[model samples]
Target: MKKQNIYILAIESSCDDTSAAVMCNDTTLSNVVATQKIHEEYGGVVPELASRAHQQNIVPVIHQALTKAKIDKNQLSAIAFTRGPGLMGSLLVGTSFAKSLALGLGIPLIEVNHMQAHILAHFIREEGFDRPDFPFLALTISGGHTQIVLVRNYFDMEILGETLDDAVGEAFDKTAKIIGLPYPGGPLVDKLALKGNPQAYPFPKPKVKGLNFSFSGLKTSILYFIQRETAANPNFIEQNREDICASIQYTIVEILMDKLKKAVKQTGIKRVAIGGGVSANSGIRIALKNTESQLGWTTYIPKFEYCTDNAAMIGIVGYLKFREGKFTDQSVTAKARYIIP
Candidate 1:
């Protein structure tokens, strides 16, 4: 007779999204994501506000994940949660919930790296194609991180390069705000970039020494440029919103692609992938697709749903870790920073 399949329930509330999923090995039966609209009122994610929202939303979110997957709590082999590189309070809610859930179910607990989970998310939905092979280049871009990572194995990863200043998402959000978009405006910026000219305003890419990036300067530059342009011609942005979005998006994408191209060259890996929220951007998608022909590399971009923070990702990561017997003790705790001790 076949063995009883092991299941893992995963939760992610590292930031604004309260997500959960149930995965049996690599096959995700259900992936549930709950986004916080409360944050929309603020110009950005207010840390404390995010935590409260997570607390309110986590229980129902988790239950829905289990129900959607048709997997009962007792059937779960282990529980996983995003434990760090996120807001402390935000991480705490998920961590505490996971710990309590695991304790209640008498199952093992596995703590997942929020960033690493984002990278591992590729394995969740399987993307309906040949999955990315090992020793490939993965760019994890989002609100707090912009990194080029080398994934050699399930848990083996090295940071080839990362942002030195503001993250790509921050750049997008700030740029969007300057252009009169609402908070969390990255998506809006992408939407507006379509009708605009990519060559409208040429923003100079910062001369960062290596693969490390610097988008903070770019954000400030855009602000000043907008201010100056508005002073000279009040209708400059009003008449050319699309152009502004296009130009700004182009500059940011160029910075990211430049480092990615270098990583491909240095690592000598032809397979490249992009993950994280910004990976959902149409511009980034087109840019990465173009790299396939331009740089002679096989490219990967997980399906749009898998790109953002979600439980299926954590479950995928959990699937890998579970096989290795990588269980975290009851004493496991959430971290706010990168280093684990």
Candidate 2:
């Protein structure tokens, strides 16, 4: 007998991006993301604006996802959505929509943790991509979070270490802002860094004990350094844009790899996988690639589309949970600080 196909509709609105996706088991059929350009004017996300955008984008985004997937609502076995660890108002938009849709369709409702979805994104079946085996290390770096997770199973995960203050992506964007870059400057910084020297200017790394990380000190130092330089040379940023970006990227990547090396030594896990928006950085990608040859470790990097905030990652998690009969009731609500379980 042929196995039954499971179709899942997933939604993710943890922050500025409102996304929807359809998945058939572990394979993504269609992933649609509506990024809010309005936040670009503010140099950062405004919670009120983000939530309002989600409300406007949710219906159309879901419609497009289903249309692209060529599947009707009746064909969906379940609806999955991000439940938390993001802006409260943003989470509510996705949560309420998923709940109402599931009830209307008389299907199961599954809630996915945003961070876990980032890690599990590696498992999404793709033509050229390979999934990591059980018992591996996952470095999750995004605008709102930075965590070193120990993944022993699909749902079994433990955060070995995380940011004490600012996340790595926040550090990147904040640094970019200081240099007069536009909002959503993280990618711009990465693009410019490629043409510059990584050691052009050295920045201090935080001395956080154990596997935990800190970036507030580094961000402050960058601020002061830029302020001091531009005071003498008003055109300092313009004259040394690439070099400055390269140095910043180098320092941040070092901090992440140092802790990751420590985590590897402590746990004796040689396989490393990375996820989240900041994982899309060229510097971080290069650093992880070097470890494969120099340190004799295996590294897994997801496709670029899965790197940033998208519903495809959420759909993959939903598919996994659906397989395990991990459905939630209508009583489920959005959580702003949900941890990996």
Candidate 3:
């Protein structure tokens, strides 16, 4: 049974985002996310630097979450943290902190999978939203991951398919760079693509043979095309900005939504949801809404708050685990490749 007044202090440092959240029962009391801006200079996240930033940001982030939630440290029933499927060093900081906090707070410690937490974000309460039932299908996309998942329960998760080469967010980032967008340019690409014609340049679609995906060809195609086009016109991208961005964004969105459609058909599952950072893309959301209507299925997308990395999602999953008497020991270790379906 679900517990009452079960306040949880959750920590998330899976990647470039350092976050903390407080959960009271099933509701998120407060969520604080600190994103690393240093990656902007390097054009992508650097593991070592990300870890360092986590070390610096975690303490303050947690303090802020608790402060905003109006919950005292002694009020927490348990401590929850993302334990795996992220950078090793970054995960370590959150793990070690959670372990220490649980020990100090004298409560149970619940370890969470970053990917699974993305799925469970649906459980975080919002006034007008409803939580998903069991056997739900999730399309989780991020800079590090692109996967279709099946959630049978709080603990039972399986991965249906994933990218064989690059993740969907990676494709977006790479494509954005090719188009001269700033670092973490995936969102920008989507925005610019809206102003441009989607058919300006046809990008190659990955014929990945199976449920697995490959975006290497698509990235290479863009790179080569850009190189050749710029060689002739130097200002080719500048001149046809909207078209290039639109075409690439269109192709990537199609690739993702197509695979998602197939996953639905093959599994005979009507309920569909999308999560992770890229789930915030306007293009993906619009496509999912349209597809859901055409396919006659219920579609779930977390509000932007839960879409990005946040400890509230972790805390929500931890709440479920806590109810099931799930707890982690001191020997619990961080895993860098946590997968779920």
Which candidate has the highest lDDT of all?
Answer: 2
Winning model by TM-score:
2
- Candidate 3 residues lying further than 4 Å off, grouped into runs, are 1-3
Scored by lDDT, model 2 comes in at 0.97
Q: Residue 13's C-alpha lDDT in candidate 3?
A: 92
Model 3: per-residue Cα lDDT at residue 40: 97
Pairs of residues clashing in candidate 3: 149-341, 150-341, 158-341, 159-341
lDDT scores for all predictions? 0.88, 0.97, 0.90
Worst-scoring 10-residue span by lDDT in model 1: 121-130
Tens-digit per-residue lDDT, 135-207, candidate 3:
8899999998988887788788888888998999999999889878999999889888789899989988989
Error of 2 at 142 (Å): 0.4
lDDT of 1 at 251: 93
For candidate 2, list the clashing residue pairs, or say none.
Answer: none
Model 1 reaches what TM-score against the true structure? 0.97
